[model samples]
Target chain A: MTELEKYIHGYFGVPTDDLAKIVTFFKPVSLKKGEYFLKAGQLSDRLGFVQSGIVREYVEANDKEVTKWISTKGYFVVDLASFVFHQPARWNFQAFTDAELYVIDQKNYQRIGQMVDRWHELEKLFIAKCFTVLEERVLTHLSMTAEERYQQLFAFNKELFNQVPLQYLASMLGMTPETLSRLRKKSF
Target chain B: MTELEKYIHGYFGVPTDDLAKIVTFFKPVSLKKGEYFLKAGQLSDRLGFVQSGIVREYVEANDKEVTKWISTKGYFVVDLASFVFHQPARWNFQAFTDAELYVIDQKNYQRIGQMVDRWHELEKLFIAKCFTVLEERVLTHLSMTAEERYQQLFAFNKELFNQVPLQYLASMLGMTPETLSRLRKKSF
Candidate 1:
């Protein structure tokens, strides 16, 4: 099975027939490095699951860009608020490297419910997982020291340090780039 | 109809029969001022919808108590991660005032699926709403200044200033109590 199929099957636990049908809606799409998948203020009508490379989600605030997340292989990317609520997007999602993704638009996303008998259950679980991940980030940000945050991220995804710009990782960890550099030197 | 009933009807949009059946599982419960609904390290087995009064969700981190939220009437209170994933609770949920709630235990929460055909759909929307709210909080914290955060919260819930300890509000907004005090004097 493809990584996307494996992820869908593992996470959602859909029966083979249902899983096959669900996967059909997602078409393969490519992006050049620095190309935007979605931009701020536009409605996010589609969602992407990264097949390869990285996508960065960031927002411009007070003339500074704050990195919200970096989506890598096997991770889904979207401005969830805009995708779910039809709000203008607040974050810009751009490819950090030439990338491939399994893309699904809103219409097909809705059609999955009609196609799969347990779509609602699967979708609910999917969103709950997202919520849980976000809650963890909030708790870490509120409670952890900058060095602790750097250490935790290093332990979790050390490759991220090499792949993304240090400044983006610093912003995502809610620290200045200089602070992240200091921690990196100490850890290394 | 009670406030809890109205909330269930409005947020979930279950049909009358299903709504009545769903509401049956939630029993009325009360907490005295300073009483705890759930405490850190315990598993959160119950979820409560506040009918009146305030409940604070806070964590002790780095020897300091960080208030995550202060839920009031019509709001739901639970360590959502613990409640959903059966993890040890990280936050203490205590009544800031004598409070009444409509609560459902985990068992009853699970049984709602068998009782209501559209339970999955409603539950998905419920979680999606929670995710969106948290996303907003994360954005505000990342993008807004301490003063801006103070102004936003004050505008949204003016009564909270008089109702709870200023320190708790300060902690929740991620500002020091002294900073909050200074901002209050300026705003007033």
Candidate 2:
């Protein structure tokens, strides 16, 4: 099975026929490090599922990029608002490393929405996951100190953090790179 | 149709039968201004859809309450992580007004998941809304000053700001009540 097929099976245990139908909607794309999967101001209609490497969603703030999320292998990466609303994106999606991703267009997404009886279940699951993450971040921002958030991040996604850069991670954690470096020393 | 029925139909637009099924799952709840909807450490199996008045999701940080999100009639409110994972809540949900709510238990939520195909689209729309709010908050935090965030809040949800308490609004804006009060004075 392909990597994308494996991911679907692992999550949904979808039958082969269903998986093939899903795959027909996808177009594979290659991205290089420093190249964007999707750029800000562009119309975003494709949802990219990472087969390999990492991607980050970021928005520029006074020339500094604030990283909002990091999408690793087997994860979906898209400016969801832009994709669903058919608008120009305020966010930028860039690869952190040379990567392969499967792109699904809006038409195909709606097609899948029509075909699968269990699609809603999967969609609900996806929304539930998004809510969980956003809630966690809100709590972290409100209640936890920067150091505490860093510790929590390590505890929550230690594996993913091991591959992410200090700068991008610092942005997501809502700390300066200098502060992150200082915390790193104190942590040791 | 009742106000509650009207609100649900406006948000989800389900058929009468499906709406009735959803209505059957909900239990009516009322709370005074000072009362809580759900406390920290409670299982958030019940998802509350606001029918009247205001509610806030909050957490205590250094003995001070930090508000996260505010829900009014026509909005959905829950400690989403707790609800999705079937775990105890880390945040407190409280009423800022004499509020009316309709709640659904997890079992019924799962039942709705099975029974309604459009329910998945509702879930997706709900999650997309959450992401949009989160994205906005993150952007406000990164790109704007505290005063700017406070200003943006009005621009984003003018009616909500009018209904919610200033302190809670300040909390959601990630500013001190004193700071927000001062900003409000400067605005006029």
Candidate 3:
């Protein structure tokens, strides 16, 4: 199986060759560190597959930015509202590290939806994955104390903690870096 | 189209015939006010589609019950984590009014996913719809003030607001009924 097929299987566990045809419409592009894959008010033309490096998604509210999601290699990131609605995005996507992305536009996405028998299954798998992650996040914020959240973050993905900036990581954890620092020190 | 097919089509926008097959797999059930369709720590055996009446889903946090969602007529109500994972539910689903629900068990649900072509389309549509709604809820709770979220809830579904209890609605809005009342008075 190709890299594309491997990713698809990782998502859906479907190995039909017809699935490979769905990947043909995607175009690959590189994003520099600090560059945006998508910004507020611009349509997110595609859902991006990360081949390497890190990225973050954020939304501006009440004159402050709230980090919503962070991604590294073998992950997908996009302003879902814009991609699905074909409207201007309210969120922004930025590369925290130089990144390689394979992107599929809305038209081709819908084409694959219509033509591929397994596409809906794959879509369900993708949605389920997103929901599972989001649910875990909500639980963490709702139930855990801030310090506990920070410690869990440090334990689960030390690479993410090292690669992403502290402010952004703190934002994603729904805490301040000073608080994060205290917790990290408490841990050691 | 049958009554059941009509309701299914309204949620999924799929063909009536496809919905008819789906309807055959569902059992219609009714519950009186104050009754529970599901409870915490029980295995959620079925998913319910509300034809009429009200249901509220809540989880116990900090020894206080927090309502996560309120489903009225034409809404789907289930403990998704429990139903999907075959585990004990973390949430409670209780009827706020006499409720008519269409129910489907896990076996039929898996069958629908594997066998029906249009069912696949409908499933994707349903997942996408759920994702959009959940995403909006997360954003609204995170960004909007409690008063703003309450106002938006009433604007979106005044019928639900009128029928659901004040305490439940307040929980969903992340405020006390007294606070919601103050906001309402301030708005007028």
Candidate 4:
């Protein structure tokens, strides 16, 4: 199975027939480094799954960019609230490197229910997983010390340390780059 | 239809048969003021719909209580992540006033699938609504000023100003009670 397919199975565990039906909607797409998949003020009409490369979600704040998240392979990259609810997009979703994505447009997304009765069930589980992940992220930010966040991130995705800018990671962790560096040195 | 039934219809608009089936699992329960529905570190085994009165979700932080959310009549009250994923709950769910609730345990919640195929679809929409609400809250906290947060809360739920303690609301809004009080005086 493809990485995207594997990730979907692992996360959603849809039946074989449903998985086949779902994968047909995802169209192949590519992005050059720094090109935005979705920009602020636009309605997000599509959601993409990262097959390869890096992408970042960020907002302009106090004359600086606040990174909301950075995604690599096996992640869905979208201004999810905007895509799901038809709201004006809040974050700019830009490729941090040349990237390959499998994207589903809004029209096809809506048409899924027409194809399968279990679509809602699968989709509900999909959205519930998203909610759970966000809940964990919110909990971590609220309850964990900055150093603990740094340690947790480092342990989970050590490749990000070299591949992505330190400042973006720091901002996403709700801390300064200097603090992350200090923690890194102490750990080393 | 009862208030909880009305809320379920307003929010999900499930078919009459499915709605009736869904409601059967929810047993009526009540709590006096200061009674806990669920506390931190416990597994959240059930979800409750508020028929009347108020509920608060909070966590102990820095030797103080930090209010995460307050739910009134028409709201579903649970540590959502814990309820969905079987994780240890991080928030304490308690009554802010004497409350009447309609609750469904995990077993009954799982039984919905066997009862209706469309339950997942309706449930997915229900969860997506929860995610959208959380997204809005996160955006407000990240982008809005403390005074703006207080003003918005007061404007939306002015009754909460009297019904709930200012400190709880203040913490929920990510502010100090003093700041909330100052904003209230300025607005008055």
Provide the global lDDT of candidate 2 against the true structure. Answer: 0.82
C-alpha lDDT of all candidate models, in order: 0.88, 0.82, 0.78, 0.83
What is the lDDT ranking, best to worst?
1, 4, 2, 3
Check candidate 3 and list the clashing pairs: none
Residue A96 in model 3: lDDT: 86
Better of 1 and 3 by TM-score: 1
lDDT of 2 by residue, B1-188 (tens): 77767777876777877777778888889989989878999998888989888988888878898888888887887878788777888889899889999888898888987787678788777677677878777666655778998887788788976787788888888888899999989998
**TM-scores for all predictions:** 0.93, 0.84, 0.82, 0.84
Off by over 4 Å in 4: A16-21, A60-65, A110-117, A140-158, A175-188, B16-21, B61-64, B111-117, B176-188
* Chain B alone, TM-score, model 4: 0.96
| Candidate 3 lDDT tens digits, B1-188 | 76768877787786656677788998999999989999999998898988888888888887878787788777787777677767798889999889999999888888877666666657666766677666666666555777888789889888776676787778777677799788878988
Tens digits of lDDT, candidate 3, A142-169: 4567788788888898988778888887
lDDT value for candidate 1? 0.88
lDDT by residue (A13-61, candidate 1, tens digit) is 8988787888989999999999999999999999899999999999998
Looking at chain B only, the TM-scores across the models are 0.96, 0.88, 0.91, 0.96
The alpha-carbon deviation from the true structure for residue B89 of candidate 1, after best TM-score superposition, in angstroms, is 2.5
**Which residue runs does candidate 1 get wrong by more than 4 Å?**
A185-188
lDDT of 4 by residue, A36-119 (tens): 899999999998999999999889977777787899998988887688779898889999999999999999988877876666
Write candidate 2's Cα lDDT for A34-58 as tens digits: 7998999998988899988899999
Instruction: Give residue A42's error in model 1 in angstroms.
Output: 2.4
lDDT of 3 at A19: 60
**TM score of chain A per candidate:** 0.97, 0.89, 0.92, 0.94
